[model samples]
Target chain A: MDRLLFGDNQFFGVNHMSEEKARAQSMKFQDLSAVIDVLDAAYDEGIHTFMCTTHDRVGEIVDYMRTKPERYAEQIFYPGMPYAHKYANAMTEDGMVGAIKRFLPDGGLLDAAFKGGMSVAKKDIEGITTLLIDAEMKMFQGLPTPVIFLQNVVVDLLLGLGFKDAFRIFAEHVRKKYNAEPGFISMNLPTLLKVLKEVGVENPVVCSNINKVGFRMSGGGVTAYEKALNEYEFQAIAMSVFASGAIPPREAIEWVCKLPNLKSIVFGASSRSNIHSTKVLVDEYWVG
Target chain B: MIRIGMVGLGKMGLSHYSMVNAHPDVEVVAVCDSSAYLLGLLNRYTGVETFNDMSKMLAQSNLDAVIISTPSVLHAQMVKTALEAGVNVFCEKPFSLNPSTSRDLTELARSKKLVTQVGYHYRFVGAFKEVKRLLDSGAIGKVSHILAEAYGPVVLKPKGSTWRSKKSEGGGSLYDYAAHPIDLVNWYLGVPSEVRGTILGQVFSRETDDEVFSTMVWPDETTAQLSVSWSDPSQRKMSTKITVFGSNGRITADRQECQTFLTDATAAPEGYVEGWNVRYTTDLTDEVYFYVRGEEYSAQLDAFVKRIESGEIEGQNSFGSATGADEVLAMMVADANRDYAGIAAGPAPQVDRGLFRRRTKS
Candidate 1:
């Protein structure tokens, strides 16, 4: 993990605070080249890690990156799995079996299918969980995926359902299978960390809403998040640092960077200046 | 009695087991399921031997035939194993996950001279059977086009965890629900020579498709459209209907009844008249010895038993027909997988010059 990792919310049109802005961002990034151009700008500025959702269009970006290997030699992809919409769309069109066939690794079809069956029949949650992770990670094969994330949609749902063991299952599978650190993104960071610890996952890397003014921070707000960061040993990745454009760049970064044990900040920016200025603020404030 | 061994005691398997048990000519000698709970329940109640493995059931039970209700992915292997054991087989629909494996199973069954059937019970539904009869009798004249739809509310939300929603386990509406209509089209109009305009969409389930739309052209040039969805909330549970259009009239049929409309008196069945006519499935369907879901299930089982007893390996719902349908489905899936731009780039239809000339003359 670096001091700043480029987020994909802007490229994918996911603005939490404003639906109008989200729609505008979606229209702007309909063309893949526009997304690549912005990514190129960020890359040129020495920001290489792209923590993105496993959207279908992201496959195109991954393919594009493959073509220009030397240019993206140091690039890292942190793919969040079970892209709910992609799977939903694929399942609606291809059917469960057909969609699995479409996404299963080229040569591991039988193995994956067998694991899927075992997962279903034996209640092998580990098998099913790992199989899904494998399916989600299929497109990122041969790429630098040092960290794979469980998307917040599922993370929070599992949290609500009290399926805490799933966190450990995901961690074990990600470590054993992809040899990558399993990261979790959630709306409630304190609860997730507590559950992750209960499941025997120590010092886990978690990303959550950790901005100034308590925008969307559900579990005890900014004070509790700061206390958890200072007291807990887990590595923290701060997201929603700008509080959906509510907080000023300098104030938000300065506030978040000064927080103890804040290992990195993930931010989305469509323009070079936004990316560069955000990076500059983090560099200036992050004394460690 | 023809001794039968049942495998995969899931919903379909249990239904088939009771039907087979009720048949005087068929005896369910043993059952197999991966679930020990289901196997134990069957063992305690039925007094029939049970096994957790299909091969053990096949080997231990002195079976003349095997009924496979396993998931689609296991169909080929189970059917292959039973056929190689010289036992007749009645497997469930979509016979195999893919075409090549389906072809292999069909070829193996043919070589062994086994009485094999695929559980496409819709083929035995009286209304659909009547539809087939009317089509074959030319009551609707030369068939020009057909529309087959199968809709159900099995998956209306994100169900990526279930085997029915997972692609690896043969989940998705395409393999699960659409096969019925695709098979019906194959039975009504011979194998399709070409397929185009496929749209596989997802409504709810994240891992597999809940909706499938595709078009096929048969050898005789008659076209058919297939639309299947498992996510439509308004649909009845597993409702399958088909409409056929011909030069003279059109016929429509579902699980309940078959209806036909004819312009000419000459193009009607024996009891049917020119205008519109309807026949309820209860009237047309044969009396089943045991009924679970519908008479079609018993009818299909009886048909399979008769085929096995009489050594008639080829028929309406035999493995041969199933393989033919599987081949068509595989072709449709492959075509659907092809670059959509190719189909999207098709030329616009040309104007009818003869119609214009006739208008000008008039």
Candidate 2:
């Protein structure tokens, strides 16, 4: 994994610290070209992996990147699955059946429906999980997706609900079917790590909140996270290192870079200068 | 041990069920919802009892407490049934559409000596709770003005109607969106005595308001302005922000952090200094056993369980307090439709309706 992975939160109007900034960026990136410009700028900075949610707009990015093969050959996507809002809108707009029909991968629509439908009918976690994974992966067919993530919404839900077997099922499918590493994003690092280890997912790639002030860190906050980092064998990706811009840039970067087992740092920025500066901070302060 | 039954398997319901089901002292014995698929999923996964009917669950599950997350229209009946069955209740917000129903339910809960809590989860948010602490501790002096605001992208375009757009079912933006901040204001400065300058504007939905703007006056003449809208595409999700202006200091807080400006540190709470001080959510929040969207979500349900164990009849966000907020909402809705002649101090010029007049068909 690259030391720095760019994220898509800023382009999608997600600013944890301030809504005004989120709205401004959202409006600025309304044009697809603006989004591409930022991605290209990240690429120029040598931050190639774009860890992004599978929002519908991202399909446009995949298409645009696929067109310019040699120009973006090194860049890759780390797509997160089952963007809840997309499915939510679909569910409300067109009920359950319509949602499944709309999001299933192309071709053999009836066959796909029968398989996915039977999963829904039987309430099989693995069936629905793979079906949705295939659906989310459809847009990134030819893209280099070395890592696929289960978003925290469902991950923590499953963790708290004590369905630890789902982790094993997800990891097996991602490895056997897609030949990619299965990643889990969660807010509760302590609980999620315990579950992952119990499920025999050794040396897993897990992304979570890791910062000095413990912003958004759950399951014992900063101390528990530090313990996990020091004791655990898994590779950890640190997100929200700046605490959504609440912490000073230098302090945030410095604190996170000193952590152990830190495989990558994912962040989002709206400008070329911000991206360059953060990249510079990681380069200067990285201790491991 | 407290045995509980979960009602309504929607978003909030499912979230609360997950949190409370994992509590060390609480057991989610049965799950109730209209969808058989959800019930089957829960029953199959966890080997818990499942019910399609609320009363049957309340009776057969032998529940000591019931957590209700149904629609606001159904909250009144579900809450009353749970209370009548001698079960402690934790319900989602906007306790009931009708203020009278809320009042009667409050009475019923009190009469039964049952623990009752309404899911105004914002009250459990660490920053918001710190704001409450500041005001109560006199760190902000006496608040004379407040600005409470909420915005979300629930309805940005002309969209088909959902339960949220129907005033009777979900109470539109006024009840669904604005209730959070309004409950905070009510928590801070009781219910307002006078409500005027109300505007129930419709941006997209024709059946109900998409935005609610009103100014409320407390008995002490402390004024608060409420500006809320669900049509703002800028906000990716729902955000509730509250600012209190006091004689000696001020406080502004949302889900992220709390900012307090004090003139003097002499009376300020410990760990806070004079001038501007900011407290991040991570610093203020206590770790929960089961973390979901936010710590507040789990904290609220944990609070309910603690209340049941401690025999606490009065909840910080009890049906009684939600009734206070509901009364204010009732006043705002009424004021929007009321017609009153302004008291003109001097001669006013007569004006034609012009473009302001409704276009009548020929």
| lDDT per residue as tens, model 1, B108-150 | 8889888888988898888899999888889988899999998
**Per-residue lDDT of A78-181 in model 1, one digit per residue for the tens?**
89877765554454444444555566555364344344432334333355556678777888989988888998866765564345667888898888888889
Tell me model 2's lDDT, rounded to 2 decimals: 0.84
**Against the true structure, whose TM-score is highest?**
2
DockQ of predictions, in order shown: 0.01, 0.34
- The per-prediction tally of clashing pairs is 21, 0
Report the C-alpha lDDT of model 2 over A219-281, residue by residue, as the tens digit: 778889999998887889999998877689999999898887789999999889999999999
Residue A153's lDDT within candidate 2 is 85
Chain A TM-score of candidate 1 vs. true chain A: 0.89
How would you encode candidate 2's per-residue C-alpha lDDT over B66-178 as one tens digit per residue? 99988789999999899999999998988888899999999999999999988899999889999989988989888899999999877777765446667778657898888
Regions of candidate 2 where Cα sits further than 4 Å from its true position: A27-38, A88-127, A163-165, A197-203, A226-233, A245-258, A271-288, B139-141, B261-267, B270-277, B341-362
TM-score of chain A of each: 0.89, 0.91
